[model samples]
Target: MTSRRTFLFKTLPAAGITLALARHVLAADPELAESDPDAMKLAYAADASKVDKTRNPTWATGQRCDTCELFNAPDGGDLGACSLFKGKMVRAAGWCNQYVP
Candidate 1:
């Protein structure tokens, strides 16, 4: 029988690899890649006046990148796959009129 320490050591690497592979597979979808272009444009256009007043009145309100569905910060908190653009990563500081939060 394997010692607890040895079992943990051996399983850790496999677990890590499995997680990495799963993330890679999820990110490889064409839909995620396709969302990048529009998201980038939205991020660039997140100015206070340009954002939808109904969704966001001030830049300090719901204009944060974390609130935008397309914002995909690599830090891995609220970031997720975007449905509008493809391949490119997004920042939490990013904002667009389409921002959900």
Candidate 2:
């Protein structure tokens, strides 16, 4: 009979691979949190450039989600999580009225 140690050794690699793949899948497709009700109230935009200055004149240039204190983007990624969005990810270049340096 196979010992517990031997069984674990044989299955550990497979388990690790499965976990890694799952993580990658999740990281690749974060939910669109910006669409949430709270975000909508804040007038969050996926791209700061797309924000209508006419509609929101208070928004100034050079403000971006990636630079905001609430932004949570991974290195080298264009999308990241935000505290306001909860489960969704926002564009690195996105903007909103809640932006803070």
For residue 1, give model 1's deviation from the true position in Å: 39
Could you tell me the lDDT of residue 3 within candidate 2?
100
Model 1: weakest 10-residue lDDT segment is: 28-37
Instruction: Tell me the number of clashing residue pairs for each predicted model.
Output: 12, 1
Candidate 2, superposed: residue stretches over 4 Å from native: 1-12, 27-29, 33-35
Model 1: what TM-score? 0.35
Instruction: Write one digit per residue (lDDT tens) for candidate 1, span 1-101.
Output: 99999999999999999999999988653422214566555544423335455544444554665666555655574434444445544444445556565
Q: How accurate is candidate 1 locally (lDDT)?
A: 0.55
Error of model 1, residue 67, in angstroms: 2.0
Task: List the lowest-lDDT window of 10 residues for candidate 2.
Answer: 27-36
Task: Give the winner by TM-score.
Answer: 2
TM-scores of all candidate predictions against the true structure: 0.35, 0.71
**CA lDDT, every model vs. true structure:** 0.55, 0.84
**Alpha-carbon RMSD, candidate 2:** 3.8
